[model samples]
Target: MSQRKRGPFVSVQLMSRWRNIVGLNVGMGEFLHKYPHVFELFVHPLRRNLCCKITQRMRDLIDEEEKIVKEYEPELLQKVKKLLMMSKNGTLHVHALRLIRRELGLPEDFRDSILRTHSKDFRLVDLEIVELVDRNESLAKAEVEKWREKEYVDKWLSEFETSYAFPINFPTGFKIEGGYREKLKSWQRLPYLKPYESKEVLRVCTCGGIERFEKRAVGIIHELLSLTVEKMLEVDRLAHFRKDFAIEINVCELLLKHPGIFYICTKGSTQTVFLREAYSKGCLALPNPIYVVRRKMLDLILLGHRNTRSLEDLEEIKEERNGSVFRTNVGGRRDGDWIVPILDSYDQNAFGSLGDINDSKQPFDGCESGRN
Candidate 1:
C-alpha cells in the first residue's frame, strides 16, 4: 500500500491474481474484508470494480514511520558505516545490505539516499559493492565490549573471564546438565579475537582450538544483531553475508548451540535469531525510534476491526467534503454481492508484476528450546 503512488490502495482484481503467492486459500477480497480496520474496501469511482485500500489509520501509521526513519537517517548511516568497517574487506554487497535493510532501519532507497549523499563516508566501488571510505577508530569497538567492561568493573571479575564473556540469558525452562555451568564458564573465559579486530592470526591459529573460533563467530553474529534496531534478524538473511563476514560455521546450528546468548524462533516459516539479552519478555529492552514506530503499527494491527468505522460513514464523510450525495452501496453488503469500483487513475503498469508478498502473522510465542 505504501508503494502505490496514486493512493494507499490497490485494485482487488490486480491483487486477486497474486493471492496464491500470499498463501491465501480464500478469495483475496474475502481475506482483505476480514480485517476492516487494516484494509478499507471501496468501489473505485470510475472502474466499478472491487478494490481495497489500507485504512486511513494504517496510512497515518505508515507516514509516521517514514518520518521517524527519515529523522534517524544519520544514525542509520552510522550503522551501515560500522557494518562496512566490520566486514573482512571493508566492503559489503548492496544485495546483502538490502536483505537486512529493514532490520537495520535503513531506508528503501539507501543506496542513493544514504551512500550517494554521504560520499565522504561511503564509496561505491562498483555497481554491486559498497566500500567504507574511512574506518573510524572509535566505531571499531564492539558492542559486547561495553557489557564486558561493566561486568569487569561492577562484578570485580577477572579480565580473562570478563574480556570474552557474553551476557547469557538462557530461556526460562532451559535445562542445565551436571558440570554444564563449569564448562560454560570455562568456555566463556577463553579469549577470542574481537569481531572488529583483524582475523588474520585467529584464522591461522589452532592453539586456542575450534571453541575459540566458534566463539569469535558467535561474537560476529552478536555484534551484527546488536547493530540492528530490534536486535534480531532472520537467520536466512544473515546467512547471505556469511562469505562477506567470514562466518564459516553453520549459522543455524551455531545459534542453536548457544541458546543462552541467542534465541532462535521458529514460530513462523523463517528462522529468526534474537540476541537474548537485548529482549525482555518478548519485547526490546531498549526500543529505538524506528522500533517504537513499528510497534505502533503492530498495535494498530492488533486492534483488528474493533474501532473501524463502516464504509457508509466514510461515504458520508466524503460526501460532506465534496458537497454531493452519490448513490453507492458502500455498506452492509454481503460478501461477493456488491460491485466495488477500482480507481481508473491507478496505473496498472506501475507494478510490472505482482511479487510475492508475505503477510504471515506469527505472534510472539516466547522463548522455546532450540532442540524443540
Candidate 2:
C-alpha cells in the first residue's frame, strides 16, 4: 500500500483501542451495581471459606476493571485504587470501602477505594492555580493593546522630527567647505562680517546656495524673504557651532530644546511679543514680510546702513521736515518718501555695497533679524 493509505489505517486502530478502554470502565460499574451485597460479604473472613476460588478470580477482574476506568479518569481512579490496594484483604477494608460506595453513590468497587485515599487539600490547591492563570492572561492582553497605541503615537512624532532637520546626501569623494563663509561675505558685500563657523565641518543644504556662490548672490538674498514655516523646519536639527539656522517650528516639544531661532513665518499674524520672549533667551526672532511691512514707518528704520539705501531702499532720504533733518522715503513711495540713493561699490567684500548685497552666495541675508 501507498504511504498515505497506510497512515489512515494506523490512526483508526489507535483510536479504536482508546475508546474500548474507556467503555470497559463504564461497563464494570454497571456490573457491580447488580449485586452490591456480594462485595460487602468480603468484610467477613469467615465467609472466605465459602468463596475460595471465586475470590481470587474476582480480585483479578476488579484490578483490570479499575485499570480500564483509569485510562479515562486517571486522577480520580488513582485516589480510589490507592485506598483499596493499601487496605487489609478482609472485613475492615471491605466494610470501609462499602460505606464509601453506598454513602457517596459511587461505583461499589471504586467509591470505597476513592474515599480511603483522595486528598481534599490537593483539590483546593489546583482550583487556586486555575484562577491565577486566568487573571494573568487577561492582564497580559491589556498590556499588549496599550503598547500598540503608544507605538502609533511615537511613529507620528518621528515623521515630524525627521522632516524638521535638514539631511543632505553628497556624491562620494567630493569635498566642499572652508571657503563658503568668505564666499558668502564677499557676495553679500559685508566685508566685516566674515564667516565665523562654530564647527570645523559645515553641513551644507541641498538648496545649492553654497554651490551657486559666485553667480547670483543678489537673487539668493531676495529668496530668503519667502521661506515657509514647513521649509524652515528642514534646518531645525542642524548642528552648528557658529550661527544656527533659522526655522519656524509648530510642534510645542521643540520649544523646550533651546531653539536657536524662533521664527513666526505666518503673514499678517501678530507675533511681536512672542518673538521678544524668544529674543530674551538669546534666540533670534525671524518674522516674515507681512509683519515687517505693516509696522509703523518708524519701526522700519535700521541703524546699520553702510550706504544711503538699504536692500528695501527705504532708509536714506534726508530732508528738512517739521524743523528736523530726518530721512524720508522709508517704506515706499505711497508715503511720499524719496527714493534712497543706491550705494555704488565694485569690491564684493566691501562692508555694504549695492553690487554685493545683490550677490548670489548670500541669498539668505536680511530674512531673520534679532529684536532690539
Candidate 3:
C-alpha cells in the first residue's frame, strides 16, 4: 500500500507485510495478482514476497464511483427514512442494519454521511437506535399498496379505503393450481389492519379467517422487508418477533402456502423469504446509494486476469442480479427468466428429511394460534 521511488506504483518490500494485515481467506498477494487492471504485482529487491500498488486509472475510477454515491445521497435517505418509520418504534437496532450492510451498499460512514447530514429527518437517539424524525407516508405503501388498490378495484370494486392488498410478483413459470388463485383472491379480499391492531379483531370478521391471518401475516412480512434495502430477509432474523408479528411458529408452512406474496429461497445454506413485489425483473426496483459502487466492484471481479470474462457474461449477471443472491447462479434454471419455482413442504427448510416429505401432503395441523 506504500509507494517506492523509481519503482512500480507500490513498493515490493511491503507485500510480505500486507499478508499479515489481510483478514480474508484469499491472500492480499493473490487478490492483487487476480486483478491486473487494479494492481501491478512484482518481487521486491530486499524481500522475496511480491509487492503491489493500485494503478492510477483504478484510483480515478474509485474516486469517480465515490462521487456517484455522494450524488445519490438523497435517494439513500429515503430508504433509511422508510426503514425507521416501519420499525417497532421510530427506531431500529444498528446491529440489524449491519447484517445486510454489504447487500444494501451502505457506506462505512453511513451515519456520518447520510444520517447525520439529514438530522431533521433522522436522529441517533440512544447511541444504537436510528429514529425517524417525522412520519409522512402511509404504512400500506411500505410494500405496494397502489398495486393492491388497482387489484381491489379490478376484482371486487370495493369503495372502502385503507384497504390495500399486497400485489404478488409471482416468479415466472410457476404453475397456478385451479383453486390456488381463487384462495389468494379470497385472502386478498380480507381487511387490511395497522401494525398495532389486534389479530383477534381480524377474526371477528373472518369467522374462522385462517385466511385472514395469512393476509395479515403478509402485511407484517411486507413491513419487515420494507425496512431492508432489499425486500428480503432470513427467516431466523425475524424469529423472535413471530408472536408480535402474528406469524406462525414454523413460518415456512405459512410462507410456502402463500407462494404469490412470499418466495422462500433455501439457497446460501440458509432460508430467506423475499417480497416478490419489490423487485422488477430480478433487480431491486429501488437502488441504494452504494449500488453504483458495488457495480464497479462487480466489473473488476467479473473481469480478472486469472479468469477473463466476456461482456456478454457480465451483462447476463447484470440482467439476473437481485438482492444478495444471484438468481441465475443460485437457482440455475432456464424454464423462465427469474422464475421462482414453488417448493412444496418437501424442501429442506419445510421438512426435516425426504421421509418426512412423504407425510407433507397429510394436512399440516393448525398448531399456531389464530391460524385455527
Q: Please, what's the RMSD in Å of model 1? A: 13.2
The residue-level lDDT of candidate 3 at 251 comes to 75
Candidate 3 — worst ten consecutive residues by lDDT sum?
353-362
Sequence-dependent TM-score of model 3: 0.59
lDDT of 2 by residue, 197-316 (tens): 111122232244532222222121112211221113222222110011222123222322211123322223221111111111111133222212212222222222222332344353
Q: What lDDT does the true structure give each of the candidates?
A: 0.70, 0.26, 0.53
TM-score of 1: 0.81
Among the numbered candidates, top lDDT falls to 1
Write the candidate numbers in order of decreasing TM-score: 1, 3, 2
Local error of candidate 1 at residue 304 (angstroms): 1.9
TM-score of each: 0.81, 0.13, 0.59
Q: How many backbone clashes does candidate 2 have?
A: 16
Clashes of each: 4, 16, 0
Error of 3 at 325 (Å): 19
